[model samples]
Structures are given as structure tokens and as C-alpha cells.
Target: MHKEITIFNETILPGESKTIHMQIAKLHTMTDLQIPIIVERSKLDGPTVLFSAGLHGDEINGTEIVRQLIVQKINKPKRGTIICMPIINIFGFVNQTREFPDGRDLNRVFPGSKTGSLASRFAHYILQEIIPHVDYAIDFHAGGAQRFNAPQIRIVPNNQELKKLSDVFGAPFTLYSNHISGSFRTSCDHMGTKMLLFEGGKSLDMNQKVTDEAIEGSKRFLKHLKMLATKHQSMEAHATIYITKSDWIRANFSGMFHGLKAIGTFVKKGELLATISDPFGKIEHKVKAPHDGYLINVNDAPIVYQGDAIFHISKELE
Candidate 1:
């Protein structure tokens, strides 16, 4: 027999999925909202998987990916559930900004308080109402609008269970990063829930390659966990490099940029990465890598200023 679970004032039902818009605050004639959501759950009982995106509203690729996943008519899980919340910060999404209307970063205010700030209250609600019920979670993201990241999974290296899940996600790259305080991942880890962060592309834009990778990787995750039937022909493995540490290459002087390298390229120390030139085409400044690593992210546009970040290099550990 299958049992359905409902949450948040019965607005979300397990067997049926829909968007639950919760009013967070009202500004005279305007009202701010947060979207509490639940996707259709499988009829059988098994592990529950949560897919969330748009914690930073402008990072929209993940939102689209989750939307596509929920609509996909795959064979029902033999024993499990899938809950997807494609957009969490409706305020930010409406404004096309990364932070909330209160200027708080929703991603940084996790496991929040019941009577705290708006962000904190939302966090508290998610922690109390949702996190307790999930066996695992996948939080999707992309680089901010001004930057682009190569498709990758971010997981903690020491956590063997999470590492296995990251590998099973099957992205082209993985980053072993420690959880920071007040982050959703850290809060989930404290609650003993393993969460994987999927990052790619740029904010507010859809890259077909990134979208395809996310869809394929998520299906692979479902198969690995036995939440979906495994297809023999859909088992091709992709190469993934593990990097334990990554750093940004910043502009040394203010000028227009002429990039010579692309994202996902391996670079050695002292490699010419870009050239900075003045408006008159005089006094060209050469930008080079300070160390050897893979360029997993780089600024795509040519215009830049002093101290602007141009490249993100990840040094492989395993």
C-alpha cells in the first residue's frame, strides 16, 4: 500500500505536485513571496530524493532542469519518492537578482529561526518541515550572471557516502569542497542528510550543454539509487576530474580584457591567460596564471576593471 505525505498547510501532496506560494512579507501595495513546493512522489515506498534550485534566483539553469525532470514520464520508481522545488526565492526571481529583497543571500541563511528575519524564517521552515523527511538532496546552481562555470559537482572529499553519490551523478567535473557555516549543505549535513551541489553555466541564461548534462546526470543519480529503472544503453560513463582546491585569477590593472583561454582548459603556471589594453591600444598588460591547474571558469566578456575576477583554476587532488 502507498501512503501520501503532505506538508505546509496541506498545500503539497506526495502523490500530486504543485507550487505553494507563501506570502513572506507585504510592502504596502506590494507583497514578497517564497515558493514552497513538492513534486509527484512515487507510489511505492523507498528513499526520498529532494531536488531544489534557484536559491539564488538569477541562477536559473537549475530551475529549468528541475522543471524538465518533473515532467519526464519515466517508469515509476519501484520504491521511492522525488520532490522538486524549482524555485525557492520567488522575490529574487522576480527581481532577477541573486539576493533577496532584504539584501540577504538566502543560501547563506540556513536552519534559520522561527522568529528571526525573513530569510531566517524561511530557512527554519525548510529545515523543520522538509529536511527531516528527505534521505538525500541535490541543490542545483550556476555561476553568477557575469561569470560562467564548467559543469561540475561539489562534494566533500572526506564524506565517503557523498563522494560516491557525486561520482554517481556522473558530471564531467567534481570539486571536493568543505561545508561552510550557515550554508544549506552544512545544515543538511548536520541533520545527517547527504546533499550534492550541481553547478554549471551562467545565471539567467540557458546553455544547452549544461542543461543536457544536468538532465543526464540527474537520471544517472536516480538509477544509482534504484529510484528509477536502470537502462543498459543509458550507462555510458563520462570523465570527471576531482579537484580539491580552486582559486580565482583577478585582474591586476584596470583595462579592457582580451581573453586567450576558455573555460575547461588545463593551464600551466605562467601561461598567458589574457591581455589588458587601454582605450588607445597602448600599454598592453599580459595576464598569466600564477600556478598550474585546470581553468574551470572564466569571464566570457572582454570588458573588465581592476581587481575583476577573470579565471577560476582548480588544482586536481584525486
Candidate 2:
């Protein structure tokens, strides 16, 4: 580890921890838009992990998780650096949106160009300043509008380090998905940084249970990485499922959705997961499971349109 590492032109030394008020852009009112960064470096050198959330401003569970870590001082990196960016998309966060002010999804325009949309500019800054120095990372997320995803870890295949971290994080389930081009994870991938996404709860709200699990999993990860002391005794023996395939049971007809199951429910093949009915209840469209599996997520919204995702079922592991 170098005595001093420069980030955003500000030099940070080992055995130091502070909030870096990095100015990334300016608001319309000429206010200085800043990205608040909390960097904690250990006295001894080890892996550098970044815990970032709120890439999509509306996804606030991640923001709350990072805030909890900071306020409680849970991130005691004994052997490495921890860069915590609780809210990267302050603009979108302020507006309670999933995209930038211009409606571009920040996450979909990663490793962005200096001269691009608000989302792209932010992404560009992050890539230029953050990803190069990170070894491992986790971006917290939650279900989008009108959706509630169960607490889970989402990752790409073939990343052993990410897989190990996901296992140690110990989310109730791990979902394997393909990498998206121009995503923050993909950008970090290009930089040889292993990053995983943690999904839970829903947007624009707080769930204490999910938050607790996220914090616990993060602590467990630190312990496994030898970056923090093990305050926990032996962990419980939970199966911690690895789901390889998942399908969304969408509505066959536009109507009101009545979910028959919630997160953590197991359904049998052809089981009725939900019922879609007209406002008058004149006609009902049954939404059934295609296969036996664990129901990981369910639509929180009562109203639905044809083709809307209502139930998310992960194929049963044989």
C-alpha cells in the first residue's frame, strides 16, 4: 500500500478515515453538487472493498444500509480500505427517481463519457476515481416500482471471488444472472474488480428485517475477508440457496392483481400464485406457477396490466 493514494485529486493516507466531499457537477441553481465519500483505510494493507448504493435514487434500501454502516461505525476495516458511497445519485435521490434528471438510468451508462447525460457524467466520474482502486465491491438494490424482492444476492457467473463473497454474505438466496454491458458491475469487471449486487425489499421504503440481514451479511463478509474481528459466534446452518434459473409469472390479462403468495413461499407446478381480476370482479385470470420452486418476489402493486410481472419463481434446485 502506498503512503498516499490520490482520489479526485485529494490524497488519502493509510490509517486514516474521513468523508471526502467530492464536487462532481453543479446544479441548475449553480450549487456545487458533491458526492459524499467515506473512506476508511486500515493500518495494515489488504483488499479494498467498496460499498456503494443508490445508483438508482429510488432504490433506497441500499442507501439506508450504507447509512447504518456509517452511523454505527460497523465498517472497521482492520486490514484494508473501505470506500462507502451511500448515495451516489443525489440528484435522482432528491427527486425520488430511478434515473437521472434527464431520465437516463445511471446504472445503464457506466464507464460513461465526460461529455454525456447527467447519469453518464456521474458514471464517468465514478469510473475515473473509484473503480480503479477497488478490489471487491457490492452494490445494494431493491425491487423497482410496485415490486418487493426477497433478500438475495445477485451475481454474474465465473467470478469466484464474488461467488465466495456472496456465499459468505449469506443472503437467503443467490441469483446468478448474465452481466449487462455498460453497467457499473460490468465497468468494474473491466477493471478486474469483483462486484456483486444485493437485492431486497422495495423502492422508496425501509424494511428493518432486510436491513438487518444486509448488515449482518456485510459483517460476516468482513470477518471472512479477515478485515474485521469475528464478533459473531459460529453462524447458523442455513441452506443459503443458489438459484440458477428464475421466471416471472406475468399477468395474462390486464386487471387487478391479487397475490396468493408472498416472499419465501414455495409453490408447486401449476399452482395458483395469483389471480388477476377486472375491477368489477366479473372475470378472473389465474396466474399459475410454471414449475415447482421458491417464490422469491411478488408484485406489491394491486393493479396490473397484461404482461406485467406478478410473481418471481426461482426454479427448484434438484
Each model's C-alpha lDDT?
0.80, 0.85
Which clashing pairs does model 1 show?
none
Per-residue lDDT, model 1, residue 299, is 86
Off by over 4 Å in 1: 1-4, 11-19, 26-36, 74-78, 229-235
How would you encode candidate 1's per-residue C-alpha lDDT over 1-318 as one tens digit per residue?
Answer: 226555675533345555555555764466555475755565556787889998898998988888877666432444576778888877778888998777888889988889988778878888887777778899999998568999999997788888788778888889988888888999998998789999999998888889888888888888887787543224555867899888988998888889899878888999999999998967999999989999888887668888888899986558
lDDT of 2: 0.85
Q: Give, for candidate 2, the lowest lDDT window spanning 10 residues.
A: 229-238
Per-candidate clashes come to: 0, 0
Per-residue alpha-carbon lDDT of candidate 2 for residues 63-103, written as tens digits (9 for 90 to 100): 99999887777665878888899999999888899988888
Query: Top model by lDDT, which number?
Result: 2
* Candidate number achieving the greatest TM-score relative to the actual structure: 2
Backbone clashes in model 1: 0
